[model samples]
Target: MGPTEWTAREEVGVGPWSGEWPADDRYDPDLLAGGDRRNVMDAYRYWRREAIVADVDRRRHPFHVAIENFQHDHNIGTVVRTANAFAAAAVHIVGRRRWNRRGAMVTDRYQHLEHHPDVASLAKFATERGLSIVAVDNTPGAQPVETAVLPRECVLLFGQEGPGLSEEAQASASFVVSIAQFGTTRSINAGVAAGIVMHTWIRHHADLSSAW
Candidate 1:
């Protein structure tokens, strides 16, 4: 048998305004005239990038997300995407600055990002901001994330794909949390781990009524 074929789906987002245009300053005139095909929510359709970012900053969660980037890990983009989805305060990239953005699906434009030279720098930034550095890894002596008491305001740090947390990164963390796994896999994808950790924080600290 041949592989099943499916019809191509219609393009996402709305076309240009049909009648009178909104007079709001937040609306993007270019997007209004050229159509808004971006991946943003319906509420954000035709909104200017700056306006959307300003709106998000006003209500961003206290928690932040960080990842080690010494190896140019492709998962960084996915982490950014998940952070944006959770409305995290910011994403801190430790080590190398350049990273693949393809997986972010252009959400990086709406997300706040920071760059750090090393784990120590990231720790310092978190400390200055009164945010704890909570590392996510399955190393020994780590608490299970499912039952751990995550800080209400903290930087949830993750490491490279296979190597996990470096010695310096682990040492800088206030505590380490691990996701429980019944399967035999040694570890899950770094991006998937990030999503799980961020969602866990949301469940513990975020106001559910504000979710759209």
Candidate 2:
């Protein structure tokens, strides 16, 4: 017999709820009646926006992610997506309020986001919250992140692509850590670097049993 042709994959998300509707306030009536096509975990399929955020807030990790958006960096969205995946306490966008959300894939809706006008503002926020600022850059005297001890309650700060961290950003940081690279590329983009540092924190502090 000849080999069969491959079938098309099913579309993502569920098409309305079957049987009795859930009475919980967390479930959205619109999503329950209509289909839910939001990019979210299976557990949050029919959840209301606020409910989902509340749920995530309850179990979010202690570490935060911050990115300098001086030039409307495209990597901001990817950084947000990765931050959401790792369940960072929140994502702080410093320097620019607006960023390209295409890479975030709507994950920004579920992730907590804060804005700061400058590096100084971010530093104040970290100080008030008792969080250390660990800047990621390949600047001189920057320790290798792989061997460094990342603080449990700290913000992993990343600079915009190409320019790297601003002088102010680096100065405000409690310390700087660089990701080791074996390739010919001089540096990794902010998005990938954010993911690596966030995962490093997860490995050191997160309770793995809670992971899906």
Q: Which prediction has the highest TM-score against the true structure?
A: 1
Candidate 2 collision pairs:
none
Which one wins on lDDT?
1
Q: Estimate each model's TM-score.
A: 0.95, 0.94
lDDT by residue (1-212, candidate 2, tens digit) is: 11122233575677778778877899999988876778888888889999999998999999999999999999999999999999999999999899999999999998999999999999999999999999999988999999999999999999999999999999999999999999999999889999999999999999999997
lDDT of 1 at 114: 97
The worst-scoring run of ten residues by lDDT in candidate 1 lies at 1-10
Expressed as tens digits, the lDDT of each residue in 174-195 for candidate 1 is 9999999999999999999999
Q: Count the backbone clashes (under 3 Å) in each candidate.
A: 0, 0
lDDT for model 1, please. 0.92
For model 2, the stretches where C-alpha displacement exceeds 4 angstroms are 1-10
